[model samples]
Each structure stands twice: as structure tokens, then as C-alpha cells.
Target: MRAMEPDRHSYISGVLVMEKTKLLYQQMYSGKVFTWIHLMPIFCSSMVRAQIQTNSDSKNLVTHKPTPTSEALSGVTVEPTRKSRSDSERPESLSKDLFTMSNLSVSDPELEKPANGSYSDVYEKYVLPCIAEFLGTAFFIFNGCASVTENTEGTGHLQPALAHGLALGIAVAIFARVSGGHMNPAVSLGAALIGGLNIFLLIPYWAAQLCGGMVGAALAKAITSDVKFFNATGAAFKSIERDEQVGSAIVAEVVMTAYLVMTVCMGTINKKSTTTLAPLCIGLSVTVGILAGGSVSGGCMNPARALGSALVANYWDYHWVYWVGPITGSLIVGLLLRVFIGDQKIRVLMT
Candidate 1:
């Protein structure tokens, strides 16, 4: 029984050892299968991690480092980007770059020639016109006052008319170089209406004429201190006489002024007129109007001239007649010129 027990124990021990060996082999086989199955996924994951690390390193290298060309270009910058730079900080590199880009020779004479020409042209067109207004007004007032003063000795209407015409003619001739010789407001207004004058300059020219006329008249009055001449009834040689010829004077003024304005429109402003002698033609027209209408209206073709003379002489009796007649005449002539002659054609001639 003891030998059988020992044999049984040995058999049991061998069985146990066999069972342990089978379990060990099974675990090894299962571990091999598991390792094979996870091999592809692990390898792929490791490769992906390595690639991500490489890309990150490349991005970091790219971000912080500058290329050689970019670094050289940045170093050669002419102007500093700083806004609060001192005068000494001005970059020579910037100046050199600008000079190179411009490609301009330092000895170029033609570059400034056009600028000089433009300046001269501006002076001729703008400055000369103002000068003419000043000089013409002075001459007109001086001559006009002298005539009035001389005629105060009962020299008759012919003397005053001749004086007015001669003064206007001489002034126009003298100032023609500057302003095209626009001495009268009515004449200027007529020119504007027919488009002979620039519309923007219309008011400015009129203002100048008015101021000049006033200055001239005042000077004339100061020169001739004959205070008795201003009085209507006190002096034997009065500046203004209250004769019974008021109605005739009014009619004559209207007709003569209208004729004068019409002549200016036809001769100077007309497109088809062969006469470029604007100053001469206008002066002649004034002379003729005076010769014709002198006896009746004193031939006041220009209202500013008449008004200046009248104001200085203190002759306000028939003042309305002078203003109403001459202005109405000028307006009528301007309208006629626009309607029959066509303002557009006149514009071309003046230009």
C-alpha cells in the first residue's frame, strides 16, 4: 500500500508538471498572437509621432530664421521706419534710392522753363487786367473833370461832349494793353451779357471800376476847389444848370447810350466784324454819339462817368434821368445783341 501510495504521488506530481507546461505554452502562444496583431498599429502610430515631431521642428526653424536675401534687403533700407526721427537720423540710403529712381540730370534747363512761362502767362492774364482798370479810371476822371471845369464858363454843350469823348478815347487807348480797355461799367456789363467777358470776373471788374471811378472823381474835385461851381443858383458859372431842357435831355441820353452799347456789341464783340481795333472803334462810337446827342442830353453814354461827374458837382436834380436812361439803354442793347446776333458767336470772337 505504501509503494502504491508513492507511485500515486509520483503520478500526481507528473500530471501537475504536465499541466503547468501546457499552461506556459498556451500563454506564450497567446502573447505571440497579441504581439503580431498590435505590431502594424504600433508601427504606424510610432511613424506618425516621428513625422509630427519632424514637422514641428521644421516649422520652428522656419519661423525664427531669416533667409540670406531677405536679411540683405532689410539691411539696405534707406529710411528708418521710426516716426520720431531727428534731422540727423535722415537716411542717406533713402536719398540715394530716390535719386536713382528719378533718373533726372542736375543740369536740365528745360525742366524749369515751363514753370517760368506759366507764371508769366498768369501775370499777363490776371495782373494786367487789374492794372488797366486802375489807370483807365484815373485818366477818365482827370480829363472829364477838366472838361467840366472848362465848360463851366458857358462854353456850351459841345465843349463838355468833346471833353467826355476825348477823355474816354485817350483812356481806352492807354489802358488797352492791360485790360482790353473796359473803362465803362455799362460797356463791361454789355460784354458780360454777350459772353465777351468771363462771368466770374464780372462782379470783380464792376467793383474795381466803381471804386476807381469814385477815387478819380474825388481827386478831380480836390484839384478843382471851385466850390461855387457846385452850387446851382449861387454862381454865374454853375457846374449844373437847371434849364427847362430836362425832357429832351432824358430822351437824348437814352437814345445815345443805347446806340453806343449797340456799336460796342457789333464792332468789338461781334464774331463777323473785321475790326480788331476794339479800343479805337469804341472811342469813335463815343465821339459820334457825343457829336450827335451832345446838344440834348450832354451825351452821357457811360452812367458811371456821368454819375461821378454829377456827384462831385452836387447835381442831383435830373439824376434819375441819367441813371434810368443809360442803364435802360444798355440793357436793351445787350438783349438785342443776344437775340439777333447770338451770344455764342460773340464769345468765340472775344476768346
Candidate 2:
């Protein structure tokens, strides 16, 4: 038989008696015999009761263990008896305890929250999402710009189209949970219009996207040779050569951006049309835009991407086309959604 285990009450009593005896022993050594005599009876009785409780607990454990034949016949495995522990001491509570200790508040429906929250809420709500957006956009711009500068012959538009498309798709997929994967300002605008994004977050999201673009463009410049950078105009828009082409280029930008944003709205935001392949569809939309409009307007559907390269190249020629065209396209999509195509909850008309 296993050794006897102590029960809670008797174990507590034993602790008290041990403390009392420790103090009595010191007093007895110090010529305080009367103090020891008074404590001895209480301490001995507590020890006897503790022994009895431990024996009873041991008997319970022995009785609870199933016999081998009974376990086999029932086809069930019997787990060993364990000492009862508080919720905090259980394995399942470890992560919750860690979250509490680290000051990261997890959303618990049953738990009451304070009206005025602490810094952790702000960090989770705003700071982290912006950082994700920044990193995602930066990586996207770096890949697209680097591919443009490389400009391997015979590849023509294929390289840049695939580069930008694939980069955007991957970036969106990675950051979607945190920041909704809006690597483009046009897409962000569309999302805001469709109620996919908060209106207040537009400014901060735009700022982070622009900053990420700049960093990504800078990184692309650093990795490529100066000659290549100059040859490609630092991946800036150089297709529109004549004044007359400005209108055509703007139309091209508007059409292509609208196409991309429309795909984003339908694939990612519209509940009825949304699918798990949203990231893939969105990427393909960019690919198609670049393939179709590459020669006309450089297919720069994202203002942040355009601004990054323009800043690095010092090329402001028709730079406004990049911003105005995409923004106009986004506005058109927003109007269309409100009037016709948006989901039921967000749609304003025909409800």
C-alpha cells in the first residue's frame, strides 16, 4: 500500500502545531519550562488527528483505484487519483495566468471590464495593427520595386506584374487578421466606404502605408545598382511622355484601380461573395491590372507605391495622376457600393 497522504484540515493543524512546537523548544532551552508544558498537549493531539486524517485519505485512494479485470471488461482506462488543486494551479490555467501577469488582456465575455482601460488595450487596438500594416506594405513595395528595377529582358511586363501581384497577395494574407491586409490606399478607401474599416483609422492607416512604401522603395534602391535604378526611373511612372497622354494615362489608372478595388470589395468584404480564396483573387486582380495597363499608365493602382518610388527618383512628372486617378477610382467604387453592389448591411439603396 502507498504511504498515507494528509488531508487539508489536518495538514493545516499540523503546520500550526509545528510552529508552536518550534517556539516552545526555543523557550524550553531559555529556561521557560512553563510555556513548553502548556503547548505540549495541544501539539500532541494535533499530530494524532493529522495521522488519522492521512490514513483515511490513503484508504480512499486505494478504494478508488479500479481492479485490473474490471478495467479490461469495461474497456476503459482508469486514471490515477491526484491531489485536488486550485484552478490557478491547473495546467489549463497557465496561459491565462501568463496573459494576466504580462498585462495582455484577453477578451472574456463573462468577465466584467473597466470603462476606462489601460495602455494594453490601446496597444492591442491601434499600435499593433498599424505596425502590421507598415511591415506588410514595406515588404510588398520592396518586392515590387526590386523586380521593376531588375527588368530582366524579354520578361517585359510579366516580371513586374507577377512581382507586384504576388507581393500584394502574400502581404494581404499575412496581415489580414491584424490590419485587414490593406496594402493599398485605394483598397483602404474602398474598405472604409463599405464599412469594412473604421473612418477614423483611415488617416493613421494611410500614414503607415506611405511610410512603409518609402522604406520599401529605399531598400529596393539600396539593393540595386545605381545604373539600373536610373534606367528604370527608380520604378516610377515614366510611360506617359506627352501632355496628350496624361488624360489617357489617368483613365487607365482609374480603370485599373477600380478593377482592383472592386475585386477587393467583392472578394474580401462582401459576405455573400467573400471566399477563402480572397487573397488569391485580389492578387490576380493586380496582376491583370498591370498586364492590361502597364504600357499605358504603369498600372500603379496604389498611391503609396507610386509616392515611394517618385520620392526616391525625384520624378514628379505627372505624379498627381497617380494620386488623383486611384483616389477617383476608389471614390467611384464607394459610390457604386452605396448605390448598388454593397452587402445588405452596408448597402444604402434597394434595401
The candidate that achieves the highest lDDT relative to the unseen native structure: 2
lDDT accuracy of residue 11 in candidate 2:
66
Given candidate 1, what's the lDDT at residue 116? 50
Q: Which structure among the candidates has the greatest TM-score? A: 2
Candidate 2 positional error at 148, Å: 0.7
Report the lDDT of model 1 for residue 264. 69
Reference-based lDDT, residue 246, model 2: 95
TM-scores of the models, in the given order? 0.57, 0.69
Which regions of candidate 1 fall more than 4 Å away from where they truly are?
Answer: 1-127, 152-154, 225-228, 231-248, 274-277, 342-344, 347-351
Off by over 4 Å in 2: 1-116
Compose the digit string of candidate 2's lDDT tens values, residues 310-336. Answer: 999999999999999999999999889
- Count of backbone collisions in candidate 1: 0
Q: Where is the poorest 10-residue window by lDDT in model 1?
A: 231-240
